[model samples]
Target: MEQGLALGMGLDVGRREEEEAASADEEDGEVRRSVEPAVPLKLLPLLPVPRQPSPPLLRFPSSTATRNLDASTRGIDTNRAPSTEEAEEASSSSPNRAVSSFRTGFSAQRGSAERGGVAERASSILSDEEENGLAKKKLRLSKEQSAFLEESFKEHKTLNPRQKLALAKQLNLRPRQVEVWFQNRRARTKLKQTEVDCEYLKRCCRTLTEENRCLQKEVAELRALKSTHPFYMHLPATTLSMCPSCERVASTPATAAADHRPSSFAALFSKPTPAAPRQPPDNFRPQPPAATGHSCT
Candidate 1:
């Protein structure tokens, strides 16, 4: 019995060890499965880069189109404007990039170039007129375009970079052209304000001149009246002179002479007239009183 029990116990212990080993192997397999995805991500830096999309081609005016447009309106000196659609399309396709590329190329040439570089530079960047061998075409904006720009000017007096770009795009105009238009609009506004101020000042000056003329006429009339009539002159500071024997005062020699009025100084220097003797009453009866007084005495 002891021997059989010992063998059975050893078999059970061996089965438990085999089961633990199998579980450990399963856990390791799961850990490896979780780590496999990360391995590919770490190798991504070593992989070759994919090709990039090609840049859009810059559109320029065709020589034939320019020639046909010029020929159709020759000798008139009328503005032959370019199509808004063509300008829009050309400007939309990485225009800034093109300019940057051109500038880089120019800088590269400026660093290392032979003599007579002027001719070589001119030959490199072909202008629209030079490419077509035609006269430079000037674009006259349509009436609608002018009106739209004017309306925009009324809203705001100035524009920033983004505003300028947006306006140029909307109007199918070059950014520089929009900037110049705004400058000219501001100038026109200033000129109009100056004219209004000048006109107002002119009116004010005219009114002042008329008032001065009226005042001068009044002054002249006053002066003429003063000169014509001596009586209208300022009076003397002395008090009025009156005769001692009369109630009336004399203002002038002519008034005194006409009225036979004696002046206060003249009356003081004149001699007094002699007085006559007194006479008795006509109905006198004093003879009895006087006889009584003398007989009694």
Candidate 2:
């Protein structure tokens, strides 16, 4: 185990040294590239509420239906078994027929944030039908009924709480169904926006990745070209032999020459001086030339 760790440390050191050398050799002209922050995938677009239409004139049973039911329809007594025909009759009234209108504590357009709070709270107060079993209690309205309810929802005057309740009661729907439909519609809108954002992020990622790959390939090609070029590879032997200033193969020749110490360098101190010549002994005398300084053709 100790041997393995030592081997690993050595390899790590070697790799670090090589990396440092490579980095040192790189030109200082290269600037660091900055990466941009990642973009979030789809975010829901915030759609403002449609402008409130002019308040509709309230419809009441002038004086005659007063005998049968109150103008506000506040006369509903839930204890009395609700008959189907009565429910139908209540619903069939002109949706525009004035039921007594009630004003809200806040304005819809001016207090949208407060309205959002109310909406979230309303969601928290949902009935069991809303939680997991929207299917079993399906309140599928008839094509005609759905068209009529859809039209009522578009009416600016009919957007108030009392109007919506009256309309739901007439349509023989629980107020919850009407509320759920709008909530679902809003959710669907937001989900689509999220999907759009996700797609945009994916496309951006692909583009950046492609660009990075191209840059890496370009860098590799440049390094390869630099490796083979004679400019850095094949300097003359004479140039290799000595620095131009101090006649040495090391360090900055220009700086050495500028400092004016090139001639009296280490070379002078290391070399021996040629002072006097010595004669050979008679025993080791040179033989006479076979022919005097003449060459045979």
Candidate 3:
């Protein structure tokens, strides 16, 4: 009987443990259901996740890669001999290559021609510049040079070859330039002298004209005086007398000297004559005239 009671108690304890395990399972299912999302997880759309940046890589060229790069660069040498395969390829395309080479040579020739033309133009421009420089040098002289030349000209109007050479050296000028300056200076001096002489001749002509006009007027006055005074023109010849002191001929008016001349003549006639001899002469007289022998008796 004790054995039966123990089995019944063991069966009741196993039942209680089974019920507690089932209740715990039901509470866990309820908690899981409440924590779940409203929408099903399988029905939601997915998004891509952002990845983190990776570290930079530092890669170096291997020896074989560097050799390949060098070979590729050196394969383009223009003077290098072609390989057998390349020669064959070039032969196959020889006509095209020939056309391209001809075009290149023609373009090179055209470029050279253009360069030659440019050089020629540059040479012409340089020549023009040189000509302009020479012209400027010839045309323009400084004040000091001009003054020196002027002083030399004052000292000598004309220059011999030796003198011109000396002056050119002293003034730092060419002999031709000095000679030309002297020639122009002499021309100017001669022209100035000619002008002065012309002015003097004009003054002399004016003075002579005035003198001639005055002489003509005096001659006209003398002619009029002679024509108006007929008595002065026709004075008697006897009225002319000579002065003993001055020995010059003088003339008196005939009417005024006539009465004086007759008075002087009468005074000359009235002058006394000498008286006759007296009785002394009768006493002194001796005899009558003596007769000749042949007188008639």
Candidate 4:
């Protein structure tokens, strides 16, 4: 086991030396690309010795040096100067061909950033326009506008599309606004007419009710009279027996006076006696006997 450990250790040492030499060769080749010579680098750790045993080959940043090298390779602008350690790492990692690769990556990142900025600006502008359209604006009509609309409504209750457009332009208002005003005006007129009709119907109903009540009262009175005097309808039909001369005198007068004469039923209730017979006139002559009944006595 001890021999194997020694052999592994020797192998590890040889491998580490070969790696360092290869890295150094790469650094030298890269250093010749730029006009300024590259700074020599140290592979020592930038930390104080610890009291306890630490892990092997631990790496850490050594101030602004690493930051400068990262900024340069990634096409970022920085004011800090690079350290010797970071310069050596940059040279080792980057060869002559690697410069073009680093520049292309940086350009691709910059193009993506610019495209994102333009997209954001366009979206913000569209949002602002949408909000403006969605928000409604309140309009207050002037006195002149109100008067003109009222006059137009009196002339015509409704308007065609052409008339609406012309009116909108004349009044500096939207066609839809004009249409709504006319609708409201017509509705008010209809409501007023409906109220008048209702009042007239109410009056007619009241008059009919009064007339019906009067007719009902008259019918009730007639029914009561019939119930009270049942025998009045069944009286006997008799003539008012009078002398011939008096009947002739009564018939010569007007109809009203004739109707005033007492009927049979009135006479029965009064119980009047028969009238006396009338005497003949004095100018009458007696006829001679046709046969000899007593020999002309």
Listed in order, each prediction's TM-score against the native is: 0.34, 0.28, 0.33, 0.33
Candidate 1 clashing pairs, residues 3+ apart or interchain: none
What is candidate 4's lDDT per residue for 176-233, written digit by digit as tens? 5576677888999999999988877776566455534544654564356447756533
lDDT (CA) per prediction: 0.39, 0.35, 0.38, 0.39
lDDT of 1 by residue, 108-162 (tens): 4443333434434322223443223232223356566678789878776775434
Collision count of model 2: 9
Kindly list the per-residue Cα lDDT of model 3 for residues 1-297, writing each as its tens digit: 222222222222222222233333422233222211111122111111112122221121364334334333544322123332222222222233221222434444444434334324322111222222221122344566678888877765665444554566676554545666777888898999999888777765664555446446545644564577545446564465432222223343446433343222212212222332222323212211111111011
TM-score of 1: 0.34
Q: Please list the Cα RMSD from the true structure of every candidate, rounded to 1 decimal place.
A: 42.2, 35.6, 62.2, 45.3
TM-score of 3: 0.33
Model 4 steric clash pairs = none
Clashing pairs in 3: none
Clashes of each: 0, 9, 0, 0
lDDT of candidate 4 vs native? 0.39
> Candidate 2 — what's its lDDT?
0.35
Better candidate number, 1 or 3, judged by TM-score: 1
